[model samples]
Target: MIAGREVAGFSDREIADLLAPLRPAAPDSTENATRRDAFADAVWSCLVEPGDATAGVLRLALGPAAALVALDESDAVVERRLTDAGVPDPSRLGLAAARARWAPRAVEGRLRGAFRSARVMGVRLVVAGDPEWPGGLSDLGAHGPAALWVRGDPGVLVSGPSVALVGCRAASAYGEQVAAELADGLVSRGFAVHSGGAYGIDGMAHRAALAAEGTTAAVMAGGVDRLYPAGHHDLLSRVAARGAVVSELPCGTSPSRWRFLQRNRILAALTAATVVVEAGHRSGALNTAGHAAALGRPLGVVPGPVTSPASAGCHRLLRDGGAVCVTSADDVRQLVMPTLDLGGDAGPLRLPPEQLRVLDALSSRRPRDEAAIAASSGLSAERVAGVLAVLELDGRAVEGEGGWLRGRG
Candidate 1:
């Protein structure tokens, strides 16, 4: 049996067996990993807390397996290894402090037990460099997760452009409705919806995406082996079926306030754009919006009633010029796919308020009667007729066998 270094008393064979189910299948590489590398990564995942920059620096320098071996060495040896690897000693904590923080937690049995529990629950780990890992996560640098605990199609995590729709947990009815409609519209337009899978707006986004048969990922604060908030268990299970339920923490790790704050970075990193559907003055969704903005990702916010306190955060984002105002999925698409020309016109298609409202009521698929259009647009029949005529002349509206509908222009 191969001797244990990080995981004392455990044989290499035992470590390999525990980690086999969680290893990512490489898409292009021909070489297989030695058992030690995989096990060391797993140990590193649970050894340090999430977003530990010092640990990230060491792993980047000495590599994960060697870093584990260096854990037991003297400060002189560790500093030499750091020098040889060209990694500067961390500023936040010295080598001794870092070792103190990591060594006590790197237990052999703890790693084994967590791996076994995850395997039993169908949870798997996707480390960095795995084909299934999201390439966007690399943008986070040292703050990124060491490995992801996933429960779903790992491909969906990075398959296409992802939009994160997040908002307050104690959401208002108006907020929930907007979140659901935005999620449904985004999915219809081929964007995967991502959320924290909490209550209120987050829950609404996930449910709407699943109802529309679109993919949605839930970036959880805790481990994938157990669902948090207890009530969202059923909803998140559906998310895992269609997209993914992912966490940076290992199995058996519980959610904390700090973890929730850190989890926001993953939601931002996984998506091309982040939209805050609704938020109060100090909502957690704003934290996510901050991360998105810091990453230079496009930020969007849905405008709510001026008087509603729940929308205070969104209004703040808009006023601060930190986010663009997005009213519909079309607006969202423009933020992500900026190169696509939505309206086929020589110049910007500026329309009167009534014409714009009527056009919004019209559908691209089925035709609607004049009366239906009038009711939907909240306009009088005479005004509707007048606007329809103006739109039709501009090649923006069409009359079909049924009645009237949207045009190709």
Candidate 2:
């Protein structure tokens, strides 16, 4: 059989069966993928497939890249190794490094259900080279996902107006309060709230997003099939039922040391903006913050009591000029969507670096072409458009015969 044989001839389920035992033990990581044994034969079947392409999908579907990531290899290094081993560059890491890695894991019915949940939650997939792949992830560089397995209304990833809320696992009252409130407000105002499904701040954010009846996504550390921090399984399931719970791994693969670090890159890459509610100096939340700032995505740090250790990291980020200080959900709202401010209820004035440029470009000039806007604002076209779209929708700017100009209304 050539690489063109229909996969229908070979059940993916069967390949998945063979791959199950290939799982290299994690660093005592999430073990959800190890719970069953029915998916091993499928792995062998996939490896021995008649065609190269079908055989390739078998590996992509199994996510061996994730196992390599767990071994501390960068996506670039991993891609090279795969290619050297004759593994085709599938997606996410077609060339550049992708963040998510799929260590060997089990294939489970629950994960199959996650595929169904994309439809159930109204989310859609953004394959590696898909036109709709959000450019924001370019910030992740070699640490982005090989492909984003998404859930939520389709196109939400690339379209606009999404922000992430992340923080400490041992959240304080203030941290939880801030997270829930901000999540609710952002959702109510039509922004998608993305977060890890950990306890403390992440959980509060997801719950608040749901309560506000807004779209939310959970970027998991493990495969979407297995919920990490198992206590939140119900919460995660509810989210999968309504929104998307994404992962970079194969359905049954668990998250390991390298996987979690890479997963943080996914959380950072997926959103145009990232807000850190509370974290300690060594906090993993800080990892997400690092990716956000490095990628030049809007980075925010919510203020907390000066005395709290949780707030220590946020304060450090602000002091280092690493992030803007955010007091309320409104601040996050502005940093991610500056042009679309609603004055009355609009709480604070923390603008992303891009918004400040648009304001500067609006001097007594009649209007400006996008190129001039980029030159004047010192922001990239993609960055400015992301900001401008929010501004236009918020009635802050108008597209006239002349061009994009500041609007009085």
Residue 253, model 2: lDDT of 55
Off by over 4 Å in 2: 1-126, 129-133, 151-159, 344-409
User: Among all windows of ten consecutive residues in candidate 2, which has the lowest summed lDDT?
Assistant: 1-10
lDDT of candidates 1 onward, in order: 0.80, 0.62
Best-fitting candidate, scored by lDDT: 1
Candidate 1: C-alpha lDDT: 0.80
Off by over 4 Å in 1: 1-12, 24-35, 89-93, 343-409
Question: Which whole-number lDDT from 0 to 100 does residue 37 have in model 1?
Answer: 60
Residue-wise lDDT of candidate 1 within 276-324, one digit each (tens)?
9999999999999988877657788999999999999999988765367
For 1-409, candidate 2 gives per-residue lDDT tens digits of 1012112122444333332332222223423233111122222221221112332333444443233231344556655656665556634433222222222222344434444443343434444444556666554433444455554333556554688999999999999998998898888666889899999999999899888877777887765667877999888887777777876554445667666776787788788689999998888999988877656567888888898888999999877653667787677776665554465555334455466556435423367677777765557888877877876776667777778876644
The residue pairs that clash in candidate 1, if any, are: none
